[model samples]
Target chain A: MSRQTDSQSTTKTRPVPPTLSVITEGSPLSFVNPDGTLTADGEAHGIDIELTRGLYREMLLARTLDREALSLQRQGELNLWLMCLGQEAAQIGSVAALLPSDMIFPSYREHAVALYRGVTPAELLVQWRGLAHSGWDPRKYNLQMAALVLGTHTLHATGYAVGARMEQTDEVVAAYFGDGATSQGDVNEAFNWASAGSLPVLFICQNNQWAISTPTSVQSGGQIFRRAAAFGMPTWFVDGNDVLAVHAATTAAAAHIRLNGGPALIEAETYRMAGHSSSDDPTRYRSDEELESWARRDPLTRIEKLLRLMETPESFFAELDESAERLGAEVRDACRNLEPTELADLFGNVYAEPHDSLEAERRSYQESARALAGVNR
Target chain B: MSTMSLVGALNAGLRKSMADDDRVILMGEDIGTLGGVFRVTAGLREEFGADRVVDTPLAESGIVGTAIGLALRGYRPVCEIQFDGFVYPAFDQIVSQLAKFRARSGGRVSLPIVIRIPVGGGIGAVEHHSESNESYFAHTAGLRVVSCATPDDAFHMIQQAIQSDDPVIFYEPKRRYWDKGEVLDQSDRNLHEARVLREGSDCTLVAHGPTVATALAAALAAAEDGFSVGVVDLRTISPLDLSTLEEQTMTSGRVVVVHEASTFLGIGAEIAAAISESCFYSLRSPVLRVGAFNMPYPPAKVEDAFLPSVDRVLAAVDHAMNY
Candidate 1:
């Protein structure tokens, strides 16, 4: 395996900023200057006013929904909440590029993607409220549940894509994870399986620069996309804050994959504007300068800046804000109103077939309840 | 309808399952061309087409992980983990993801996957090749665990496990793979029911998987010694055949449990605990258990000392009877 990394010395020597976000315009790909402004040529290619306005509305709503969930957790209404403060552009742009029939395996914290896919704010926040493990039916939305384990979902995405190929369907699969997960063996194994089998799976890597508190360089050795490329797959490194770039890259990647051109990797350079979760405090491990630098290049801020250039209506902005407020209110109401899971639910569905032990447990529970309530079974 | 070995019965069962449902697909390492190291999946790739019988990468986690995805797409994927000791690589996927998916999804979706693993020892194989790790999966909430001590069970239970909509850990007694048994033309038993292998009035010996043969042999030996020793094969380890276990053990008034896994938290422990609670009044003894010590599976040369032999089971049985 060490020999397999023939370019290791070369690859390891080149310091590709683990969270570098470079924007390119036309042929030869001129970079967007450090000021975070895109070239006119890049803007003209796919940045339509409607798309910009749509991305802005979705991004703002995602933030509002995230804020409400965070408040709920703090208010002791919800057990815990993970804020998807940054990487909205990466999640929104990439997921917006896919058809609903195509499957998605998300490594938790893709709140923007879930919102874009019409996973209602109520359903999305229900899990964080500790009422249900998942609120919506994955099949109904064509999205699997948000997997909390690091890189495990990538294998599922590859397998699903392989099955689609086996059935001769042109359906594609998308897997989303962070840079820290790239170091995991399961992700590497998924790359091999997806490439060797020529499966139509899209690897969406949100390079949030931090896997919790660990820096990408400290966690990952070489370039993430390059790792996938070594496995005989195409690779794309994109500016995740640039919604147009992510959308264009993912759209093309999805096209190539649906055509059965094997798997493709998209390393979306993004940042976690908030702490890892509600329990985390970014002030400890990270420098203020770095946080300020990335915050200035925040995905929502960048998208808002782009939308402002289009002279988007105040009415449009006002309507989105109103909708976001309504979404926040609706989610809070749903979480509070959710019925507690019945005691029977614990013993039910352990197996599709009936089992004696679970039945006994159920009987024992009912009997205990009966004894408490002065009844008989 | 015909006599067959456990592995042969498994191959036939897999063939039948795939034929019955187009969604039934087999995936494993070396399962395609190499026919698996044990050849339990022999000729499946050719007959079912390479598309259906996929030869997966050498990674165990990848095999089970991908199978979960296939199941999500409505394909009843049956994954064959090559060996017992190597299954830890897939432990996270099996317990956290595969086992919990249906429950996490609020029952809207199910991962109907059958993970067929050839388990147990006495094969004189090297380290990591022989282990009884069924207890790890049996302890998990969302997964069903079953083991076959006979070829007939290998045939019917494999099919039954494939048809189940929950993730099932199917343990095949590797040592008994070559032991022939008559598979009836029909199966009238449920997938989770325990079978009474022998009848007795004095004591009942509870065993599962590879230990069932040892328990049966021990029971026979006890009978020759003027003792009436019954045997119960616990087909399903997770949702244990508790009713059958209660009936037999309570009737006999004495019980001994046997397994190859560590005695501390193994299925033997589970059985003893359950019987101690349910058959407390009827019990004549303190539910003795004969199993391996609480340690990793030793090298093959010394496995005889580690595994519960017929004599060891008899020793436990005599202890129970005397108590």
Candidate 2:
């Protein structure tokens, strides 16, 4: 393939800011200072504390689920499980900002988002457990099914937003992807369509710093938020590790998108403290020191510290942990006791009406299997 | 009601679709002011405005990715890939998301997205411009892959592809874009069924897209000899329309499959397998395929020789009949 050297060289020579200046310019979006003290302005905001506490509980719950799912995979229960160990804050905080009417298109790692949308732990486990194709019906909850492709869902979300606007609906659509997805051509194409149509879409990028083994630097030249400005969408950068910051950023961004007809982007600066998936090993590409440094800024830990400083009751923490444990047990049992999938189920729902050839093939396969089992006798 | 080239017919079909449905939108690189490199989207921006007819950045994956988002929001997006070979950047979206969305959503979400790709060789284009990547999409479960061989089919099939609840990969044969044919005002034909373009009794020749024209030309050449040949245009690649193919092969007792893609794992392989299984006892000879060899599609200078031509189809038909 001939290298498109001119474009690459031009992009490289362009002087770009290191990150979004909005974070430094201070707005109502920040909850904690760089020194970890609660902002005096934030303490006066009652809803901010409640939302942060809720986010903390949910992130912890998500981490518990992640651990259990990984264990299940090791125990030969699931075929595979993509862990969102270090991404709970990004998922929970971003999802927490969604209105009931708003829709979310998530990439596969957004387990917390599904939970926030009311998808039961059992239902979510079915997909990785190999018992079901999708976790739940998208219509029942505004959350669309998880997409495994890196950046494809962005287009689907943009199309959905355009559709919503055509109907004059007030709903906004949010698409969640990772930093690595910024390298995908579809991600950029989505920006084009969303901007041109002025569709009501909130494009959230959870910049977890890696696309599997590839690092963020390899994916793009600089911050992904800058790409949004080029597409004519106002972009924001948030400390993804801080749930309060993530929630505020996403809420503000979604509000801007709903009030305006165009798209907005939020690049959550975060880290993936865990391996990309159960099958991945971070030791191959990253060092333990880097992982430990990110762990210190854990989203859950910061929220817990803030809650403690406020002298929140011990019962609050106790109840939250208890509930998380119960949720984990329920998920484990559901995964272990999953029923064997029937062969007929595969062909039953491929189309609205059964296709004639598919039905014939199904019947033939059933008859042959019955003969082999001696059931025909 | 009017006659137009396959490309013109497709443009008209898109115009009608956009006019009929406000949710219908056109998106791709250079599709706006430039009116598409091939002018397939000419006059669309002026007619529909920039909102409905969009010129996206040069990112194939992003175009398809956001189209998925737009589809979820209930908009019907028709995305253009510029060329077939350039589609790889967006393959993750097409195969993983677009192809699996309906099933993944348990039928709750139906992606009414149509991805238009200018496919097949003979365009004398650079690398990634001329390719036959239909087999990859056809093999994917949730997607429907179809191609148009004539202007009538182009005019009708493009609309049908847009209307289908499932995402459809609409492959436009670049080489046949300028080929003109009569397009009727109304089409009551089933989009999934294979059509018999010509009739014969000696052997059955199966092809689609660019090769459909080649198959017809070869059938004519064979008529000049003492051979009678039947031609079946496999418009839908995924569904295969094997029932129609079985009927044609059974009548002829010999089969030859032709395509612009490589022979290995190409559409021909599936058709050959289906014919052997469906009409095993009625077959007079083993099924033969005339296609590009297993290699990266050669550079444009040699693509004419690499593509399946009328001579290659005739040669394969001869080989099949000799049994």
Candidate 3:
């Protein structure tokens, strides 16, 4: 998991600007196409069949868990769930490419990375189920609590990289955000900060076409990756549906950062196949034609087509299907079995230091609760 | 012991803190090389190096936002917001992110970050240079807000805040930065406790930061007028050491709270409400408040009339005593 390079070439001491031609080119760098074939760039990128298969399995598990959580929301078992339905490759691929010790500050919708990092179904569901403000301890997983305020976490990731560099650590910090997040000032400042400092950070923009209902065209003036160029960061525009492309790009970017080549931005162009959240109705603003067009270029379907073309055994698919079913059942039970939070628990964690005012408030609340209990009983 | 100005004392405190712990770093605009606009961070960059005392990009949100990240990585970051009025740009990061991270993480995360804001109006600076917005952070649940009035308090309190595990909004009275006083080798009081600067029997004058001096001056004026008025410096704003406030209120039987912030829903309102709740029967008169009128901080030339002055404090004390 540690990408600690022994030494770098003297030329690598200074940051190497990204390939301008590739970034300026409008088309996304697609590795695996829908026709069960690799594109020219994909051929040059060279797919690791074994790693691709593992990535596909992770995506399948994510897809299965995503479907189950959405069902739980619909059944009123959970309060809300944001689906990682179509951006599986973007999430799984980018997370897998980074070192396990690399800290990640993710936006609320990075479910696949959370699961991959060993955050349990119960831990992930507690927040969505209205049980807790946060589910898992970030220190345990090196993953921060989901930042609901858009684009704020990018600065966190950049600052973390700065601190890590000051500590002389080789770990590259990463942030997962969306197309809309690129428009935020904090995110732009982060780009400039990381670039100016030559800090090790990988900004992964999962450009899922729609920020709720606003399409990428309306969300940004130009391609999201091009925005990074303005800050002198290495930029890559990759097919988010192609897991292999994301893995390659991210792995390369992480290496460059480790080699003191500074921060990099990768825009993984994918589509959000589901409504923004359980509460959102995307059909109101988008067309069925657009949805149908994206469904054909689905992240899961292309990976499956490639695996089938490679004659990956039927047993692998069969075993994975069994695992997915098991996962669905386990998540359903976990969501239902989460412990309810108490009124007193809210007061306990406001500050690490002792606070007299909060304690007083808690005591008053306890008395009121007791009075209410006496009346009800 | 050394006699120094508030600016010099703060610089010494920060130097001591950074020297004591390698993790303590300072980040803000003009803090590095420039030594801050008020020279509070003077000579720190040369001693601590560029990495430790970072001059950040001119983005308030970025300064606070990144400081939170640095705190997460086990660094104690003290961010200097250039001015009180300039803090709004970083308001969301301070209020929504830095303040809430601990509770949001269920106490797993502790952001030992200090936001040093030079606050209040008096210097006759341009618009947006003077403000007393401590009420905003004080009203928020997760933050600890404190202000320093004298040189000694500025020296000790800045060091204490850096060591605090909770995120602290540290307000330095801008107008009082150059006021000189003796700073002790170490403090004998808790960071959040209110101290009775002067004792009297007739009435109590409560204030913090810049207003503490005015309250003390008013207390002296009241003594000359044959009225014994006490002065209490409320160093802490949030957890508000209500016991001391209540004790003073009961002993004097009358109370007057003053500050540079607007009286409308300011810290005075909370103190008045708390006093009423705890010691209403002991009070000989209703708790009165003296602060700026409810309006945007006026132009610099007129701030002297707008800010709580010695006269304003004496008027409140008089009102409380006569009532």
Candidate 4:
């Protein structure tokens, strides 16, 4: 059978989602309404104006860096790049809600989350530049290294959550993945385990609409949030473009986990505004009109409108622009200054302890390199 | 030390290891309540509590995947994959995640996880259940694969494997689960070293896991035939301790490798390749290997023919002796 079909056809007993009717350009779960004002549920939109402005600033800086990284890859400085073009609010909101002790396990594209966690720009680009396996030290941030496998980090996060619970630590775990990852067996297994163990894992899946070319509607029969509910996780579907909505949802989810309420799956509905990567051309699969529609509902632009509603002056916008420009410059220098990795790194880190067989191979390669040099001379 | 069955010794070893370290967790299907199918983890959950000896959902990937997380969280998890054939579901976790995490993390974090699987064929069990799929793991880098032949090694090695600061695939020969031997107070043996069981001058019988006893029996029979042969119990197969293998080759000048797995691209093939490279001048004859032919593990009724027995090892020894 095909993976994604109409929900009624897939399961006769399962009713259509109640919230499916309310999911227009605006969702009731959204904190910031279509009119650019906070929704009636004040608790859900509890984040203050100060924090909202800070989130906007962080998102803007992340966007600046992401664009420069994309440009660098185009210029042949980086091997390849995956940009967080439209999912900045989703990552920024959820990461900001997390406590300092909570561990984060992110899939490869969570660049903004890593930056917010104090991972330097040079550390982020070194892996893309073909210098190292991972840029930042995982233990330092209580965040794991960027996992390339799509859905695997969910299981890792669940396991880590279970471990922390076992250790009696109140620290929670959050795993970040895309919409496509929901289709993987690892993610399903992760769901089963988290529910079974009553593990405190905040599963944040940025449903960015496209998995390379496959849309979410084609990835699964039902809504992504519905899958989590089936696994008995407290599931929340939010408008990911609204930073306030994401922050409020994640804050509640984090509190639920910290209070021993078990795992929660928050599916942030967003869009991937750019191609899948530097190698992809989205025009081949998706039409420009659909892109234009999403471009109009851009998260940054929506927040800018709200900032004006709050009577924020032009100087505030000017200061943000100034900081973003400087941040972009720093990212450029960081990517350029990363030193090339030595050949010895390949032989190193194979094992914590010394290994005779690997050492012999390393020695053999060195001797051959020297021989080739002599011949060239 | 009392005389104990291999499974009993393993159970005792697990209990001791858990007691020795509070962080060691045991997870697998039916392990907690059912005490595992083979009862290898019998009586563990009661003492350790349900939290420590967890009865995981019937998902191998989930078991290994979560164990990797627990390892990251500073716990040494020993995961039991129900049987040999059932291990493929967890293969990705073992190979990609558990095996690669420590090295890829640049030595900052260590995954001290143990994946214990009952391997090899015999006892008329169904297909899938009876398998010797050790080579797939042994071939993977960043994994330590070891097997135990006797109760003494089973008792001692389980603790040692748990103690290592790396992921170790501990394969227990299921056919020999009932085999009895004295559990010594302690064995002054490192976890990865090969052991010289019996010394001879004519040939060396190299084997591991299920086939080690067969090789030993072959050596005894070969002695009566005036073909003095040595037997080496290859305890660990990954960082293969070939120094003992080299010693066997140098002493006898002729050696025969044995395993229950298919000889085609098998662990025996690796042994032969290493011997050919290192013992090119010291060897008297080509390293002959006796293993199951490259075919699916046959039905139980015909498994005796498929598995390497004492006769097959002796036949290989005779062939090498003729050389």
Reference-based lDDT, each prediction: 0.82, 0.81, 0.89, 0.84
Q: Whole-model lDDT for model 3 versus the true structure?
A: 0.89
Candidate No. with top lDDT: 3
> Model 4, range B1-323, lDDT digits (tens) per residue?
89999999999999999999999999999999889998998899999999999999989999999998888888999999998999998888889988888767766677899999999889899999889888999888888899999999999999999998889999999999999999998889999899999998999988998888999889889889988899999999988888889988998899899989999999889899999999999898999999998998899999999999898888888889888
Fnat, model 1, is 0.74
TM-score of chain B of each: 0.99, 0.98, 0.99, 0.99
Candidate 2 error regions (>4 Å): A1-21, A24-30, A33-49, A67-79, A164-170, A188-199, A209-233, A260-262, A271-274, A279-295, A349-360, A375-377, B32-35, B44-47, B123-127, B293-306
Indicate the TM-score of model 1. Answer: 0.93
Candidate 4 or 2, higher DockQ: 4
TM-score of each: 0.93, 0.85, 0.97, 0.94
User: What's model 2's lDDT at A369?
Assistant: 84
Which 10 consecutive residues of model 3 chain B have the lowest summed lDDT?
Answer: B313-322
Give the lowest summed-lDDT range of ten residues in model 1 chain A.
A1-10
**Model 1 lDDT at residue B37:** 88
- In model 1, the clashing pairs are none
Better of 1 and 3 by lDDT: 3
| Ranking of predictions according to lDDT | 3, 4, 1, 2
TM-score of candidate 4 versus the correct structure, residues matched by position: 0.94
lDDT of 2 by residue, A1-377 (tens): 11112112211211122222334233324466544567654554333455556677778878888888989999999988988877887888777766766888889999877876777777788889887778787866787877676777787787677678767887778999999888876677778878977889899999999899999888889778878877899877777887776776676677677777789988888888888888898899998888888888777887888888777899989998897898789779978887777766676555443344667878999888888889646
lDDT of 2 at A233: 91
| C-alpha root-mean-square deviation, each candidate | 7.0, 7.9, 3.6, 6.7
lDDT measured at residue B45 in model 3 versus the true structure, 0 to 100: 93
- Show model 4 residue runs off by greater than 4 Å: A1-28, A33-47, A373-377
lDDT of 3 by residue, B32-85 (tens): 999999998989999989999999999999999999999999999999999999
